[model samples]
Target: MISMDEFIEFVRGGPLGPIKKWGTKWSLWPVHLVTACCGAELAHAFACGYDGERIGALNYGIARQTNLIIVEGAITRKMAKVLRITWEQMPDPKFVIVMGACGLQGGIFWNGYHMVKPSDVVPVDFFIPGCPPTPEALLRGIRQLQFKIETGEAKTSATFPEVPLEAGRKPRVLPKSPKKISKAPAVIVNAPKEVDWEFGQKLVEEIKAKVEAKSVTITGKNRIAVKVESDYIPRAAMRLREMGFDHVKNVNVIDVPNEDKFIVEYHFSSYSVKELMPVIVNVFADIPRENPRVKSLASMFPSADYMEREMHDFFGVIFEGNPWMGRKFLLAPDAPEFPLRKDFKLEEEVYVR
Candidate 1:
């Protein structure tokens, strides 16, 4: 009269319990999911030198075919979705092991705007701590997962020695940074440089004549900087297009909080002209930081569309005429609004004993 579910549970907890554990421990298949730089170590562990497969864990590329997931490195805001989806696709009785210092607690990228903890997205069974852990450390993590599977208890690979502290001694205070942090971001994007490219001199003269720029200076051999007012951004882009800069390589925004301005830069390069291919003309301008708005170059150069959307997501800068503005393009839907702003606060962590 017992149900099938009850019968299965009975078998699992009954005499066949050890058999199930033994089978699961030896055949741990970790799905391939590389979110950051820690992937290199994972590869090193499985490669010919280390041969991690000898221990029964194999790295599978497809999610449905695996029961274990090894999340490698920093999971950014956008990457959280992928991690969740992959975890969901796997069959039940699955396990997760997050490796690297970034996955554990953000490591060097502590308090970063886009960093996401892997445990936030899935049920992590174990964590392998290291900036980029040695291949041996990764293999040991696999063994820990296996031990957990066989015995229903997770074990630490290493234990630290307890150091005795001096009695009644005051804690030493470290000195603060000698340099004062600037209220505004200090970025030297357009420092003037001297170079000996004969073609660059002619090109500078041509750009000055065509584009209405505050100053047209050749920053380097293959670099030219054109500073313009916010209102003249679209016009300057159009004039540059007429010359030979057919595409926008990148669209960047610098948030200067103290100055109350945002510097919008468009790096333009050419595919149509052979001579202009090596030249990168940076057309940049300043706009009010409070409510920054710049004309979209998407219509003129389609590549600027995605970068423009990314800038809006980061700094809340409005790219006027861009169809995809004011939407979460590069970050997760629940990510903090305008996270790249100087005043944006990160979630604080609490340590409990």
Candidate 2:
């Protein structure tokens, strides 16, 4: 039996070759596979302002019916699998156009642990380079693909002339890298310094009166650090809840492997109280890195539910009462376990000279 590539070549070599190519070129329906922030640019391209349909490419829903895949922005390790699966479901004579610098390389997240290049997972026909490429650039990429289809050859829309260097001029020298990577950087999760604030002073007094805090310090403007033992977090959370901290703004876990501890902080704020809107109280505690366990504050602040699960996924910290404990939340099933932990290193890349 002939393969899909062979069948396509036969069709192209037959009497209806021009007709097939023309039809395919003009009828490029792209399946929506938005993986990241670059989706914003893709939306602008198809929206009323750009009207990408003018070029004969319509953004469709299903993978089987579409002939093109525009991979938008950063394809995470998790999204790469989905990208491959989507490509497999597309019909024969399918093409791929990877958009943004993230799709080509890693863009801003070049050294990120979760980032995966789209090109590594799928056969990309064209790559549009930008943090997020402009709508015009995306449309131009579509045009380039269409040209490749009809003419069976790739052509650039622009050309540049080569310039010779002057006789006494030397080649440009790149400056040395300024980043000083430390093997063991001192990780100070909470070393509180005093800040002057009248409201902060009053707030600290109120917290001291209500909750049994290990230490209360005004970290910055509108920011307060309330330290407590791991066992007392739930109690502290309960007190904060009563004090009008209705929501958990953020749940953060800092892995201090050098110190053999993990700092868990739940930033709390209130939507009900207008005065508390800008105030962020960080309720933090340090737990042994080897046996990281903390009482879940989800019961007190229901908004901490997903945040706790995410922290569980990244740092392998057990939030005792959270139902999603021991289960994956934000990270993929096959992704490296406890990836955000300082001890968990990403796979190193080697560039060929």
All-Cα superposition RMSD per candidate = 2.7, 4.7
Candidate 1 local Cα displacement, residue 105, angstroms: 0.5
Model 1: residues >4 Å from true position, as ranges? Answer: 171-180, 183-190, 346-353
In TM-score terms, candidate 1 sits at: 0.90
What local distance difference test score does each model get? 0.89, 0.87
**Model 2 worst lDDT window (10 residues):** 344-353
User: Which portions of model 2 miss their true places by more than 4 Å?
Assistant: 1-17, 32-65, 81-91, 128-144, 151-180, 183-199, 273-275, 347-351
Clashing pairs in 1: none
Go through the candidates in order and give the clash count of each. Answer: 0, 0
Candidate 1 residues 229-316, lDDT tens each? 9999989999999998999999999888887888999999999999999999999998998789999989888999999999999999
CA error at residue 331 for candidate 2, angstroms: 0.9
Candidate topping lDDT:
1
Cα lDDT over the full model 2: 0.87
TM-score of each: 0.90, 0.76
Q: In candidate 1, where is summed lDDT lowest over 10 consecutive residues?
A: 176-185
